[model samples]
Target: MTYYVAREGSKLWKRVLGETKVELQLLGEKWKLLLVGVILQYIHGLAARGVHYLHRPGPILQDVGFILLPELGKERAYISETVFSFMFFSFVLWTFHPFIYQSKRFYTVLLWRRVLAFLVASQFLRIITFYSTQLPGPNYHCREGSKLARLPRPDNILEVLLLNFPRGVIYGCGDLIFSSHMIFTLVFVLTYQKYGSRRFIKQVAWLIAIIQSLLIIASRKHYTVDVVVAWYTVNLIVFFVDKKLPEMPDRSTGTSPPLLPISAKDKDSKSKEEQLKLLNGNSLDTSDRRPRTQVNGKHLEDSNPVNGDATMNGT
Candidate 1:
């Protein structure tokens, strides 16, 4: 008799991964880290090309249970194709936005390093799981609403290269356990919050992530479980990366200390003139540092309820 793993297996599996210690001493030293980061772009390009050439097509396992997602596969191959194409490029292009704009330099650099680590780890896991599960990928079938969805069938090496993975050169087999689309999507969501400005752009980035995830599932291109796994996997990656090394903060843009009512100690220790000076933008004590806001005349103290009389009257 054959045995299938219970749903409880998911928790058991995660527990094992959590207990596993991951150590990379290569990045332990500051000098080595600096050198690699300086040339990360070139390294990434080489790695992508390496992965592209290494992929070998083989027979993937198939099962009827999760062959096609009902919600996604409308069989209108055109819609599926269009959504896939759009998401593929959208994900790829967004990865470069942070570097191109150079908004939050440290966050961008940290994100790039973490992403590279995640990619290498994910690719390794995919290979192991592919053999272990022996599950056929959803890419092998395209069905939507009881109709056959027309889809591209790239048979040869050249065709596979031409129709590569959305974010990079990796190609999907019949049943990859996780979705690559979501990985890139979630990565952007993290980097953008730290680096991205303008509320409109941030909102649009989130919208695209939502649509891409749903689109992939609805089109029956990836199993529902695959999408879920991708979400969890990204979380795990983020956690591990941050646990080892905290996210690098940009020193040039130090946060301004918020204006607070003078403490009892401050009032006792300093003169009235010193207290007033501190309350305003200028530094009162020894430091030459100035407040974030440039005060031409009227100070930000006008907006504060700590104005003493203003708070007492409740005006």
Candidate 2:
């Protein structure tokens, strides 16, 4: 039940050596599902990139949010990225922060599992919505004279997939029906709200999420609708996901059961049965042997006095 803290050295090494084996086993048990979640993320990225090739010159819609808010232009749009990076790393740190406390209930692995579920689901939906209709991207990269706005056709499908593997997402255009940024931002905040306890910190996280959303719009990184759609869609997806998935076991009191394979659990039950059988066998062996007594200088088995009395009365 001992939790490891931030300090690194022999103490941490020993702690990990003692505890991480079961945690790793627990994670390994669901590696296949986790791998699927990972693959879905990659596919989501590929879909987003593939759809980027379909960007075309089109009319920008009259967005009320955009109309009211001033654009920061391309030069200053990076501010949003800065704020987002802060929030992103803050969440990452917070996920690991519980390791330092005695009352830590959640583990980092479970947190990522939930994160993957929410992200993959939302990204899948985003892929469908974005590709359904090519909205003219509102980002600076989608503007005239921008290389990304008019990318040359790829020689083959492999080229499309391979070319986008590492850097294409940065320069890609037209995957903007719903803001991927907001999806991540909102998902992180909502997750923290559920798993974390600090009310003040949660309020600050929500504030940061809101600022990040507004920044995405004001910076022209995404249309107002994209951010707006992301707000509700991500929330709903997380809600449904939480409802569908089994609840994570709480480890705060160290009384929560550890995840075990069916075989292991079966073995435990079998051992208990064997122990019970042994107990029953010992009881039967003891019951079969009656006490012997010397009576009237002769050995005789002890008889129930009540049975002897009843027999005399009947005679």
Candidate 3:
């Protein structure tokens, strides 16, 4: 069966516009997709009577403050709840926006990859980790020697803010279960390597993920061991999937590139021109027919007279 899709003005527009829209849609879809996971986690927690089957080491310093200063204990709970609420709402918005609109075919692949990684694979891994490790609860055994322990002290306004409203609306038990960090970072790195040009941005983003994971561990939000395992697991899954999955062909070569309305002939012609321009180092100008000379002894003639010389010299 044939499918009808909207076309854009140019190949560049098609690739960029199509990809952008797809990304937005995929992002939105993730929130909705995660809703099921959220419900399941809550159900599981309720079934377990708010008792976690497995837990990682907690922050020793924070635990000490809780024991020594009861006031800090109250503050920590409040902060945790507040931060969690904020993170939850933000996640809802970030993950649900895509379901409101239809996405193009190119985006569908990306959307599926994310859904599989977070909604399926990551959750499975967490369950296995929980079962195998048989760790303590989310807040147990916090001591200086524990990998999950954090130095207990309000260092600055940031720590105080975190202490007061510990939980951001973005992350929660449900999110933790699936390790969104792993899913997102893996997808982002793979996607960037395959199609994106911003290598620096991708690298920076990966670094940020690593730092954030460390911070979470240091803060006693998650076990250092869990985070480490999650990093390797996610990277392995992404790498395998990326290797097995077929690379997307250059859509501009086909008759209908996504979001581009131009015919295949036009695309081919444009690409040919572009290739020629790159090779010759001269772009046709729309101004006077001045025979511009390149430093490398090449000559170019302007086709139209509206603008000026649009040629470049190799030298």
Candidate 4:
């Protein structure tokens, strides 16, 4: 029995592995591969920027503009950072969690496909935003001796610091063109639409993302118009991609229909079978048949008779 059980377990493992391999193969020609390369490039560019400026001198004047509006920079960073983190971690969990915990094979497939979709959407948006339009350089200056000065005041250190951190970090991170946060939030909300129980949580997450984006705009880390453009760009990309590549079918239920209350037709069919069984019980088994006999002044037949007595008979 132990050997049989071990053999069964091995077969199940092989089958699951086969399914995973097939799913991966199916994605080889899809947009997911291109998205993966895009993500790699994004990360590499961040690393390169960090190395390029690691030992540079203190922050420049335009850097000061970003530093003062930390809230703004933070809002921008929050959207991208949060979404990217969610997708990356989700994918990690899907791949490693199942192996460690023996989770349902189909659930793993669903998660993998979801992550792939997000990655594709994200990269596609990034490409669009990068090439959309260029912002003018920070060379414009205030008119000489004008009452309104362009540079931040010395006392605005707190504001500068706030803006500085997000801008410096984000610029350093190489994700300045597009909003990762918006893309991820939209994707997650759409993908998990079946989870009606978590609607509040989803709403809150969206609110947080939007609030962060607003802060980025208000603080001047990004122009209000730039944020608007980013938002629209993300939405447009998502819309087009969704139309072209509808989400992969969920595989967790083994192609079964969703669970629902039993139908009247099903119940009626079961009831008919039960009633027929009751009506035909006697004919169901030959062994249950009895030899011919009668009682209470009725004629009867017996296979054998004892002492010529009709009552004491055996068959």
TM for every model, in the order presented, reads: 0.45, 0.78, 0.41, 0.42
**Candidate 3 lDDT by residue in tens digits, 1-315:** 122223323444556565566566545655565566566544433322211312333333333323332332323434533444444444334333333333222344343444354435555556554544433424332333544333344356554333233232222221233344444445555544554335785676566565555444444454455566677787777677666755544432454445435669999999999889778765566564456644336453543323323333222
lDDT score of model 4? 0.48
Residues 1-315, model 4: lDDT tens digits? 999999989977887686566545544544465566556545534432333222222222344324544443333445544544765465355454434333343344444454455556565556455445433321111122322213334365454434344444444322335544445555554444432235775566566557656555444434444456566665666566566754544444467543235669999998888778777543445575556544444434554434336445642
In order of lDDT, best first, we have 2, 1, 4, 3
Model 2 score (lDDT)? 0.81
- Which 10 residues in a row give candidate 3 its minimum summed lDDT? 166-175
Clashing pairs in 1: 61-136, 72-218, 72-219, 73-144, 74-144, 75-144, 136-174, 137-174, 137-175
What's the candidate order when arranged by decreasing TM-score? 2, 1, 4, 3
Where in model 3 is the C-alpha error above 4 Å? 1-105, 108-119, 138-180, 252-315
- In the range 172-262, model 1's lDDT, one tens digit per residue, is 3433456666765666565565555568877876787767766676655566777787777876776676577655555236563322356
CA lDDT, every prediction?
A: 0.51, 0.81, 0.46, 0.48
Q: In candidate 1, which residue ranges exceed 4 Å CA deviation?
A: 1-110, 140-171, 251-315
Which candidate ranks first by lDDT, i.e. highest?
2
In candidate 4, which residue ranges exceed 4 Å CA deviation?
A: 1-129, 136-177, 194-197, 218-220, 256-315
Model 2 agreement with the true structure over 40-125: per-residue lDDT tens digits? 88788888788878888466677887898899987898899999999989888888755444457686677788899999999989
